[model samples]
Target: MKVSFDPDVAMLLRRVAPAGVVWVLLALPSQSVYADDYPCRVALCVPSPTNPWSIAACVPALERLFDDLAHGRGWPTCEGSGVSMNYVNTPFDPCQGGLNEAGPGAWVIEGKKQPNHPTWFYTDPASYGISPSASPQQSAGGDAVANASLACVGKLMGTYRTYVGQYNRDYQEVNVAVYDQIVWQKPQSPWAIDVYQNGQFSRRVHWK
Candidate 1:
């Protein structure tokens, strides 16, 4: 979730960048040979981030990401493809009441529907169910990572929070805080990226 503005913000993002901020798409296995071996349909969406610290980058209009993840091998995220990419954004505080340097502008994501508000603020399984996800069977993480993180934060605050995305692919496991920071885009080795902003990859570097 990036705020569109003067080149300054772009330049800022270019330098600091979000963590796991895949500057480029991940490379995938050739579909002609291993199409059937991939996981569930991939879905991705880049939510509009109105400010920093907002939980909007997590989920937004996800139909497109879900589509490509499920149908287009050319754009991995679905079967034979890999993971999904999506974004959500928090609204800017006109009054500048939030804890943001440039007003309350933050990016957010919504992989799972939240509770009791409107849209992300208020969600109900009975009314707005969670997205379809692959069984945790072959997953390396995903729901599990979410559950784990929730257990820690939920217990501390004594209130349930949002679920985070945990890549469940077979290739590798990666820390996803990158979605927020946008700085981990370019990392040195020891960090064999199994997952990237676009999808999955082999040994190579790309700049988005």
Candidate 2:
């Protein structure tokens, strides 16, 4: 579903747009636009001391991953702790905080920073698979937001690193301006998130 505002409407929006507002034009996949059976809201849980979109501010690589996942396309490689689908059958509560434990593996999000990079952040979508065009500023902002969100979730989930660090966690910072650039970019659609885990791929997490 390619969603575009008519030029006239766009002009009108721009004229009346609030300060700091940016308009985006997107050509999104149909699966992203349509509803689905997966009631559980899923987020990409890249634990391993790392963390990793929508409207939802998203990039081409992210969008592509969602599209590919919906169509039975292959998995995108992940580094460090690898990715997992932390699912919450109900909305809010667990989904906003973190996923619950399941089975023997103790499905929890936990990790310490990888040895090579202490101040590491997961921002490179290309490393996973596709490297869509993105400016340095856009990438940096996205990385900041991703790291912040990860740390926030990690702290909430009672992770050792986040708890011990005494870092001032602000979940609100997850939506800071720096990260907004990634989603506000033009020409791409962002509907959901996909992650490869447990020797198989998780379902496409439809946009809320």
Pairs with steric clashes in candidate 2: 54-57, 57-183
Against the hidden reference, what TM-scores do the models get? 0.16, 0.22
Q: Which candidate gets the maximum lDDT versus the true structure?
A: 2
Clashes (N, CA, C under 3 Å) per candidate: 48, 2
Name model 2 segments beyond 4 Å from true: 1-58, 86-208
What lDDT is reached at residue 25 by model 2? 26
Once superposed on the true structure, which residue ranges of model 1 sit more than 4 Å away at CA? 1-54, 61-63, 76-194, 197-208
Q: RMSD of model 1, in Å?
A: 20.8
lDDT of 2 by residue, 1-208 (tens): 4467544434433433334533332223344542221111122222111222322223344455556667877555433223454322321111223422121211123222333533234323332222244212212122233312211122321111111112575322121111110121121223444444455553434333
**Which predicted model would earn the best TM-score?**
2
lDDT of 2 at 180: 12
